[model samples]
Target: MNALRCLGLGLLALALPVHAEQLPRWEVGMGVGGVSMPDYRGSDETRNYLLPFPYVAYRLEWLKADRNGVRATLFDSDKAELNLSLGATPPVRSKNNVAREGMPDIKPMIEFGPSLDFNLWRNEADNTRLDLRLPLRAAIEARSNPRSAGWVFSPKLNIDFVGLGMPAGSKEGWNLGLVAGPMFADRRQNAYFYTVDEEYARADRPAYQARSGYAGMQFLTSLSRKFGKTWVGAYARYDNLHGAVFENSPLVKRSSYITYGFGVTWSFLQSSELVDVGDN
Candidate 1:
């Protein structure tokens, strides 16, 4: 279901200012949980799914991979770095959506690309830093007639804190992150989800073509912590499509919405080696 997309975005949220701390070399296990989310970006109808997912990660000197995606460090330094980025979006089924009554069903999308980040500032005392991030992705349809769909770009500012920005947090506590940015899409990508052809138009829904332009703005937050053998994380995302180029499309039903989810996992397989602490 849409859980794959949720899982993708959840992994993206894991990206932070690479901290100078030893991390487990690997954590191999699985997580059992469920995801509840809207059928599409702005749809009011929601779907819930229950499934098990692998939670595998290998931390290396210049590479990292986990449930979120993979990162191959191409350039690494104290001030800046460039790396590959990957994520995904869930499918949209017209049959189950009111607004998309007679339209074609959209499949899950696989997004992969690159990201460049610059460290804007840092508070060494609290291990907190602010960074400017730019990521561009090419979306590929991943179900029911797969093909290349479109591209997405997001440039945002991020603030990350270790141990909840508290001096005592070093002992035990929470970590937090915040990112705010605007979303943009190319014509082909925008049209894939919002376009309506004349033949499929009805009295209540007229034919319309989607254009390439601003898609929306999003504000997202993540709070997570590790306790004993268990790790827990939570996230919330808010999207406002007030002035989106496709807002007038017949398939669009709302101008704004919020999505939230949480996941917990217990590691049964783990690496004994501690990662080399450095900024990358």
Candidate 2:
């Protein structure tokens, strides 16, 4: 059932045109890469979960610019821009050790959330600048073999520095960023497979009815260069979670870990006409 939901969403994402106008204003992008989550505490030893993450986003510019819209655009300057964005992170897989004696099998997990972006500064002359973004997300995740599911709310802050200085036609450059935040999840999501009481709750791990919260922080940085109209970039991030519930949860015994990877990014749309030169 969970697999079907994931497949349906994946297909839906694919069915949509690479560049479609579902909303009044939007930009579309698709990326492929290798991702690894290593050093989660619950496991007997370090385990690396390799998977791919694909996503899409839609923005309503006119509405955002208006005070009556769901989100309002606060700042628009030649060197800076700020906007609110609602987005989602589809289901992805995670590898886990089942037998305790052998390697782990791949499992599935899903997440989605909303975010705000602030362009701190942009230098047309230098092409070097910085940007800040904050993403607040609420996610529901489930596992394949154990048949366990949970809900989590996370608020993450990211800072980016772009080294855009290069030859006029050069497509190569680098970007570095940092990510830090907190994640809170209910106990039902943290319960063990066998300990769940099915009679009380429809899902597993019903016995653990306590609300568990944790503060987790991660650092991410990336570097990339453009090829023709496409840009290739790679990034790495590390996470550390600390709190009573996180420390005691069986699912995440090791609260500190590192996730790092390399990927390619492509910008499908670029328009100088849409770019605003002054505050409206």
Candidate 3:
């Protein structure tokens, strides 16, 4: 369950920097990685995952796809870009979780919406760039009995470095990325994971209601580089929920935690067609 979410985050973490270069219009491959993270946002229980993931990249004029995920470019300019974005979270088995012990299982969720990204700064000489990304998405359960889970709005500042300070070869430059942001979610989304109904509340866990507002803050850093036909990457993310609206929920066992993982992929096939695009 967590594998899909972990794979999505891993791909985003390994996103390539922005630069003008010629690359295959499409590339396909596969890889596996190990991840360690909390069962849920604030849960004390953790799960370690070793999962296989597909690697695909398709760069079309209006549709772009890469490690950062697929995007339908609605608008593009020298300093700003508007596109479709996505997000996901793993489900939780209540019976297996200490905090959620007699409650119903939490379903997996998927979010999709538009994102507006601004290029704050770019130094071609130094191969560095800074960007601000604002994404607003609506969530829905992924299972057959799907239901709305409210919405989320997350805005982050991202910085990327390419070639300037990396150990990779000149042809295959390394990229370093850093992102930090605070998240906000609606009441329904919060309640889906934090609310403890009276019927299911226990002595140690009283009935609680979750509110809409500050979800938390996160800081993530990643490093990656392609070696010939193989690409390798790693990332670490820090999440803090000290001031979240659901911080008081009994299910929230930790206010802060770290998620980390690494993986490598070897591209066995790529299109002969090439496109002039930013770094990949």
Candidate 4:
């Protein structure tokens, strides 16, 4: 499960935002970080991690592998873009969790689908940008004979600040991002995490079927900076499952929690050729 978490974090760390400037079209690096998070969204179990992640970035006209996650552009404009996005979820072992003891383990899952991003506002003088993002993805378990988990929809408002609160003549390029959103999922997706089978039910845990509507709400903040060949960054996310459809499920041990991590990366390779990312 930690390996799966590392993979997801690696993908995320590669998308660090940069100030508008000419930059290499590609970069490769490695990063080490520590993280503290729950076993799953609603699980009470907390785990700390010290892991290494590879960093990769690529910029292209129709395909961009940058701060927005890996994407294949289907439609593009100055104010809006429609693209395919990818995401992942770490697995949970039943044996390691008290609520899931004696129950089946959950597999790591990958998600991919289309996303529509709209630039709602921008302040060129302050270098601030705001966007509304809507993404719907299909989830699939990772393993031999992978199975479909279900679909998830998340709509969020994202804001970014570049070079904010920096000292005069500071060379460091700092980016701060804030995102908040509500999540929704189908019955099958909710069931994957919340369902309890009759055979696995105990005196304290009753068999229950999960039906989905609202999953939860989340707020996240990320800060990153680039210093010469090295980059450092951290992020924290707050998840609230209060009033969620699965709140009543026996597996939901906590209603709110925070996940956070920080990392440092040294870019070992980058393209000699520069691309005009000033307006990107």
Please tell me which predicted candidate would have the highest TM-score against the true structure: 3
Residue range with the least summed lDDT across 10 consecutive positions in model 1: 1-10
Better of 3 and 4 by lDDT: 3
Give candidate 3's whole-model lDDT: 0.79
Task: Report lDDT per candidate.
Answer: 0.74, 0.39, 0.79, 0.76
Could you give the candidate ranking by lDDT, starting with the highest?
3, 4, 1, 2
TM-score (all chains, Cα) for each model: 0.91, 0.53, 0.92, 0.90
- Ten-residue stretch with the least lDDT total in model 4: 1-10
Better of 2 and 4 by TM-score: 4
Model 4, range 1-280, lDDT digits (tens) per residue? 1222344343254232434566789999887777788888798898777778777779786776754466555665767778676777677788999999999998988888898878788765536778798989898999999999888898999887777677533335677888899999999999998999899999999999999799999888888877888877788888999999999999899899888887787789999988756344
Better of 2 and 3 by lDDT: 3
Off by over 4 Å in 1: 1-4, 8-12, 15-18, 165-171
Top lDDT prediction, candidate number: 3
RMSD of each: 2.5, 9.2, 2.5, 2.8
Query: Which regions of candidate 4 deviate over 4 angstroms?
Result: 1-19, 167-171, 278-280
Candidate 3: list runs displaced more than 4 Å: 1-6, 9-13, 164-171
Backbone clash pairs in model 4 (N, Cα, C under 3 Å; residues 3+ apart or in different chains), count: 0
What tens digits encode model 3's per-residue C-alpha lDDT throughout 1-280?
A: 1222545444444654577777799999887777788888898998777778787888998788776666665665777778677767777788989999999998878888898888898864637778899989898899888888898888999998787454433435678889899989999988988999999988999999999999999888888888877878888888999999999999899989888888777778999999877632
Model 3: how far residue 215 lies from native, Å: 0.7
In order, how many clashes per candidate?
Answer: 1, 8, 0, 0
> Per-residue lDDT of 108-194 in model 2, one digit per residue for the tens?
454444446545554453344344555444334344444434554545554444444655322234444455556555555444211
